[model samples]
Target chain A: MLSKDFVGGLITILLGSLYLFFAFKQRVSALADTVGPAGMPKFLGILMLSLGVILCVQSVVHSLKTNAPALVEWQGEGKRFFRAFGLLCLAIVYLVLVSILGYVLAITVLLTLVALYLGAQFSGQLATIAIGGAAILWAIFVLLLDVPMPSGILL
Target chain B: MDTILTLLPDSLNFYLVLPAILGVAWGIIGGSLPGISPSITMALLLPFTYALEPSMAIVLLASTYVGAEYGGSIPAILIRTPGTNAAAASVLDGYEMNLQGKAGLALGISLYSGVIGSFVGLFFLVMLSQLLAELALAFTPPAYFALGILGLSVIVSLSDQSLVKGLIAAVLGLMIATIGTDPVSGISRFTFGVSGLLPGIQPILIMVGLFAMSELFKQASILEDLRVKTSPRIRFPEKKLRKRLILPQSIGALFGGFEGVMPGAGGTIASFMSYNEARRWSKSKDEFGKGSPEGIAAPETANNTVAGTSLIPLLSFGIPGSNSTAILLGGFLVHGLIPGPMLFARSGDVVTDLYAGLFFAAIALFFIGYAIMPVCIWLVNKPRPYLNAFILALIMSGIYSINNSLFDLSIMLVAGVIGYFMRVMKFPFLPTVLGLVLGFMIESNFRRSLLLSGDDLSIFMDDKISLMLLTFAVIFVFGSLAKRLIQVLRAGT
Candidate 1:
């Protein structure tokens, strides 16, 4: 029901509060300067908190003046958010598998699965592109650039 | 000039030449893709620079910027979509010209105008950056602190609709910056016992995550556009058309030269302003949007000119005015080269090498732009799924190569999610990046100035340079606030 600005402001406030708590907890040394190490962090925290409050106030004022709820909505917003979340999950899976499966295998599997996930047909052509693409990347990163890749269980 | 001859031998080196050509080729390919921005294109290349010499690495990144700016027009002319934000204005007359079967001519004019703009931008960059750097030589700790504040002040302009949100984003970035170590003291602040956190989260990781990975995430949710397969040959403008284009190109160059130097007023704005001005000045103003050569010439020239002139701030003041230049600044940091007045004194050769590299990039843009046309068409026509998948794979691989640590990869993915939410929230990324990049400098200098004055705040007012920069920052912030207030009042009325 809240506007995006109101929600965002709340989140910023939460973050600022947490940051301020940690900043206050930071230890200072006897040799530390007059303002010390925690000074900027403390300043940034207060600044963020103040700005967040201002944003919240502004959003509330705007809603009151317009006499509207200002509910945030976008067409297909949920679907898009979920789809993006899915891709991120898949990337996380790739990261976990990468150390176990090695760079070439993990990356090849990632390429194929992501392609299919994004609406590619499960054809031999897709296979070739995925395999070929992974191999080429391998050659470029490991061979030409001389940068090491995660070897893992399989070469 | 004696400067040119002195730098000639270094310019002719094979190491520099190869990166310039390769960077341009890669940039044209990357930029011609609709979703790939110049910053993302450059960020994708950031990890690879670890193996390169400092000069070579900087050249590669800088040249990519040059190529990418020009490359954006390919899609603007061929398809209705602009490849980069700056190329959006080109879509009007560019696509119109394509529709009228003058696609090749349109392509030629874009390329030609872009080169002219590049040369013009380079002239200003060479002339002005040195002068500015000389002026900045007198900077004290307070002055540097004020400089950082001045850089951060651009956030007000960067924030589209909300100063509060922009300040919030910048504060968040500053918080992230504090996670590594306390600059004045030897104590660590908020590392949470993670070894990787000690390095304070590399700006490149944040950049690649924010710009490239977040873009991919967004693309995943959207339906891919149906590919249009048409290979339009490029044809250079004849003498008559060239003469006609001169006025519009000059207008673009001047606008771009000025805009590129201002923080946050990047290529997109310059292109639009140049297009409008060119229309106002044109004798055949009636043809402004109906496939007018001037329309294509103006925006294209302005955007490409921005590729050179945008570096002026980065070179002179160590301040990155745009996303692409921020990535370039990352390149400099990667090489242990700090950009600023001290940079000129310490690494003058690198500066000269950059000049040489940009010169090579401009020449390479002319030749490579023609030869790479078919490749650009073919690449863009490929299935969106394959392109997205490969790009993701590239990002993952590139992030791993940085420290050979999986922790960095995780951090990058987290940053990507933050970037995605930031996009959804309508929060700008540049201010956050500016904060992250400039945070340490601001904090260190602020503390140092205070230490010198025994915690007295008046030391900032005591120094002339510091006073001047702080006054500028105040003007920028208040000016932005006043403008926002006016808009709010008008809306209420």
Candidate 2:
């Protein structure tokens, strides 16, 4: 059985140290009082560093203790994780493409891909959901709410 | 009182009623689904309220919470699964009652209890918030700063399992809040040369991404085939049974009101505690988990009661007491309105409208829950893949609709990933959000107070209100740690 806390704690510790360095290096005005622009960041950095260290210790202790609750990672869960991660990657690419491809086109394409990922095919149901859903949202957001969406190239 | 007379008529208008009912309808659908929460529902629907009047928007979000609290019991009774966390206790007797061929009875009791609890909770909301607001009217900048610190200190209590993880999350949120231009210095802090960062990151983006997107990502792992019967489920309680429900309902209202006012003890805890108390005092205690009416009534009533009363802290001190109210805080800020004692003094009319609308939502829950139970059950039992896809599309489109920035979309996706990691590690999400909400309050006020004085730290100690608030914050953090330590030591022994 493997637990997530130790790795999470290590990440937090690294992030905390980075923030602590950034906080200490910032220069502010002489008129600054006991705390200034750097004050909050420094305080938070120290807090995170200390907490992360303690969490790392706790995770180690719990993992070693015989009486501690078992924390198991299921086999084949990696496939599920990657499946969701793949959707996230698709999202990031679609976001970048929105600047050039326009929201309607990008969204239609993205939604089609998402529907497919969720098991829908490039059939009528997928077309109606992907295209219709995008059109309806564009109308609601742009026409009704007056939100200025990117028209973009090839719209 | 006069404001209520004026605002009561406005709450019934199409603008207010439509969103309120619609939010309720959406809330029920969301609540009846196992993974969807009241906060997530509110977060998803928040962007849609951009076109709504501010008063109407508040009503819409608040009413959604009210409806979701009751909607959670539907799945609890029909299936063994509790839709919302607050409904977990209801499953003990609710599902048992269902197995005994009394599903409608359990649902009817749940609805009745929710309405009664809501009315009682609303009374607490009006009385407590007004009283607290009156007290807060005398607070200066230093006091407000201390108050914000006190709110942040709740992370200690909210992180019941591990305070260390909670602090890390809060610190992360505070650091994120420090992005954009420094308020006091009039200089850009961490914009990384983006013009959109000038106004700082939108909390709504973070909220939708954290709650909605993370849930969508999490849904990829869960594969369940939910089933719902088309049988009509409209059973009203007999007069004799209604008499038996009163004691547990009263107990639930008491526990709910008490917990709602507390920062970290939310509706889930309140319902569970109320169930214990209800069973302890009931005549038929042996039937507690074996299809007793009191078991269903106690938790359902208690959780729903938290809906209105949880807003007391938000409305009075500009500090959200729960995650759902945190989203409501976002709703307030989106409209360029800040809530506090000033809100009561300035926008008394809007506050009145919200109260009237809450009153309307309580009554509306009964009619709406009865009318739409079958539809919600059908929707709940629908295939997960299509449902997840639709929700994901709704969230992404909704996020893009607000400000229409590619950068904002990226921020949301990043937030969703961070939120997912936080969830995986069992860290509390509430503190991170409160930190974000209260970060500006704590920083701006702390510096402003010192600048107003001649670099005098004693000014904070001099002001009675500010000193009291800081003292309370210190005690809260230290006291919670000490209590948790004692419990741990006792367990080890």
Candidate 3:
């Protein structure tokens, strides 16, 4: 039920407070000595805190002035939400695998997984998919131009 | 004359013959493929140009730019999907004509208008680039810093709906840029004691993730079957459509050229602005969304025209007119050619070749874009979803291959997530990229200028150029605020 503006303002205020804490620490130094390291940060901190306060105030004002749109309740039935989340997971997995399995192998597996998740019709043919995907990847990175992918033992 | 004559032999072989052909070919391929943009092609080609002669390298890059703009129309006319973001405006009427079995005619008109618009845009590029080249010689560090900041300010208008989010993203980008080591004092700001962060994130990989990977993530939701079965019906338009299209095309061309002249405004803005004007001024305003040919012609003409005009600021002053032009800056450095005031004095022949190449590229794109578009439609409209997956893999691999570093890949991933979030929030992603790209330049210049002035703030106001840049930045920010206020008032009423 929380408004995006409210959430955004809360985060800004939290970040601004952190900045202010840092700014205060820098304030103990002499003004001339402080100018180089802390001048911009201190100025930025005050500005950020002021902006955060303004945002918080604006969100409250907007809510009071107009009827807020009802937040859309998350429906548990959506495949899309899971699929997007899965993509982030896959990317992270791919990143970890890249060094061990080699870049080319890791990329191939990631692409196949993504394509399958997208419910691609071409997934019916397993070998064809791998060959086709690998060919395109090789052409772009290896043949057409020399991009140094981790060949490792796979080459 | 003697120097010109001596350089002529190498220029003829490398600049004229080789680069022009390569540029047109790349344009046709880039344009024909849906989602593969000219800017991407330019960025990809940038590394290869590093080993080539500066004059030839520049010519190739410039020609590719010109060709890609015109080439985007091929897919837009023959199929419903635009080949590039710039061609999105053309899809309304173009696909309508295609459905009506007039694909050939739509393509012909698109090619004709693109050629005409590009010529007009090039005239401005030539005239303005030369003038700015002279003015650029006087540029001070403060002026450059102001120019960079002003460039980022223009992003407020890029997505007017989420100006706050855009500014946040831009500021975030600047903050991120402050990582590694301070330019003035070599103190680490936010590198977390990592040596990799010392060099900072590379621009190419960031761009790849921001535009390409983020788009892939978003497209994951579209039904894969929807991409597989649509038959692209293309037909050439007849006399009636031509008559309606001509007036709007000419009208759009004028504004399009003007939009191109301004930094940060590119085809998307030009097309949107022209489309609105065309609707407001048209005799048959009711037929706009209903596949009016004028709708297609107006935006299409302006979009391509903006491409040629975008080069003006880039070549003349080293200020990028758009994101793609910013990417092309990599090419500038890679080829050992700097693109500021000294560019003209150092490499006049290269600049002239670029100018001439753009003109020729416009003509080549017209011929190639028209003739090969139908085939391109057939190729791009393949109903295979795995093909897209394959291409996506290739693109990602290409990005990885560039630096061969896992660090850059991680940066790309982070940027993609940020870009995706920014998109959902209606935050303009381009400005963030612009800010990240220009942040170091702005910061370094600001420091240098301050050092030069001995902490005198009057140095910024005293210089004519610096004052002009600061004034432009002020006007852009204020004007955006005023526009938002007006919109808010209208909504209230």
Candidate 4:
């Protein structure tokens, strides 16, 4: 099986190809005008294409030469990945709901959800994390730093 | 230097007192915490400085920069976990000495080296930056374009696993850079008619996204498995280890200074290189990887040394030496201060205050270093899952607070996703961000240089400095290609 490195390389190469195509179209202006804005991009597009070719060649060579199967290792925890992703989604939802529910309420709920989702090891640490996060945000942004955060109608 | 001194007297009362104490405390706490960088601390404090007298604000920011470098060493020596990337090298020998029961000796060596490097770098920053700024007055648009290209070439050395992927990411960043308004021709390349894209992406938001928020996204994914399981034990170093560390630390500081002067080389490079150098030069090289005092001393000294002198280019020219300094540039701009020759002549008071603060900040760091060492050791060695979650929460809140814009939050999430994939594939992300920042600088300068010379291609080759910079860029690119070729040949063999 091909490794993540190999797959990632292929993906990048495809993206580079699309960019190169657009850059080539723009190069007509570079050829016609003096100091065309397209010169650098055209140069970069060609350079990227060359790099993409090299990576593709290297990946093919590695696939051919290796006798043993490509190693697949999970670098770290799957549970952690899910928890972080879930919390991130919750943040997005909070952002969307903040306009309707108000900034303070949305942030308070988001903090509580994130603290719990992050798996605070201590029994009542969830409350501490939530309160602490909210307090710090309020003090730093709302009061001192003067950044405008959402204020819910309830607040 | 005379100009800097003349303005020192007028602001003596304000610059000397409060900023020093506040800066040192901030540095200690920020430095002790893993993943908190001094640059971010300065950026957060930047907005408040707008309300203060110029001298006071600059003084406070400079002090924080110096104090943070020393603060990072505490955790490295105690827990075998470095608080910042710069301190990562220190853990090798420092933790080994701790295992052998000589934590005090290791701490002593780190403190001593930190002070020495700080003093040396300060002396150079004061003297050399002034001299360079004078020379920088002669720089033209063509010169800046060449310098930008040279800076971008440094990315080759930074690519971790796949140079190809790194190059692609860099090019992509450069493309994104073209999306804003063009300075010379006034024709936007890819702004796509979005009014918000007119001013281009702010450097602070990009950095906050690239460094801070993206980091939290990746950390969040690892929150489940990141349990603090280490048992805490502290012991002062033996007399023998103390004697052994002095020479190694000195050697590390020398390389650290060299790294600082070179643009694009930051703490990570300095620490790793100096650590390896110390091992190579040591009598008990085999003790390295296992536990050696020299291993820790070399890297700790180098990291701090690099941290101070890295400001040389940022101050002397308008160029940033590292990611941290790039963010610092935003702070400088926030105060309506441009960092080059204009500031030297126009805002001399601010310059003097910054210099004074930097000098005292190093001194203040020594005290903070000792006081916080024990706590840092405990924090790292003691397992506390709750603290990690707290840190994660802090990172999220801090990033969100920077720009109340929901769009920036989304950008942060997208950058985080990109960062995660890059890290997993062993592709270097630093180069991508650096390329992005430098891309606009290069494009604007290149176009202006062309327009200045009536599109003459000979102008780039005409200037001596531009010639030298382009030469270096060619060498770096070819050198990267050669290395890849050699690797391929070895693989074939």
| Top of the candidates by DockQ | 1
lDDT of each: 0.89, 0.83, 0.68, 0.67
Clash tally, candidates in order: 0, 0, 8, 9
For residues B45-92, could you state the per-residue lDDT of candidate 1 as single tens digits? 999898899999999999999999999999998988889999999999
Best by lDDT: 1
Q: Chain B TM-score in candidate 4, rounded to 2 decimals?
A: 0.81
User: Model 4, B354-373: lDDT tens per residue?
Assistant: 77776676777677666765
Question: Which of the predicted structures, 1 or 2, would earn the higher DockQ when compared with the native?
Answer: 1
Candidate 3 per-residue C-alpha lDDT over B196-281 given as tens digits, one digit per residue, 9 for 90 to 100: 88866666666667666666565665553323134433343467877777788877797789988787668878887888888888
The interface RMSD values of the models, given in order, are 1.1, 2.0, 4.1, 4.1
Worst 10 residues of 2 chain B by lDDT: B1-10
Candidate 2, superposed: residue stretches over 4 Å from native: A1-3, A27-34, A67-77, A121-124, B1-14
Model 2 per-residue lDDT tens digits across residues A6-118: 77789899999988887887667675666778888888889889888888888888878855544454355577678769779878877777778877787777877776777
In Å, residue B257's CA in model 1 sits off its true spot by 0.4
Off by over 4 Å in 4: A17-46, A67-84, A121-123, B1-24, B35-65, B223-246, B272-295, B333-352, B374-404, B475-493
What's the C-alpha lDDT at position A93 in model 2? 73
Highest-scoring model, TM-score: 1
Q: Weakest 10 consecutive residues, lDDT, candidate 4 chain B?
A: B223-232
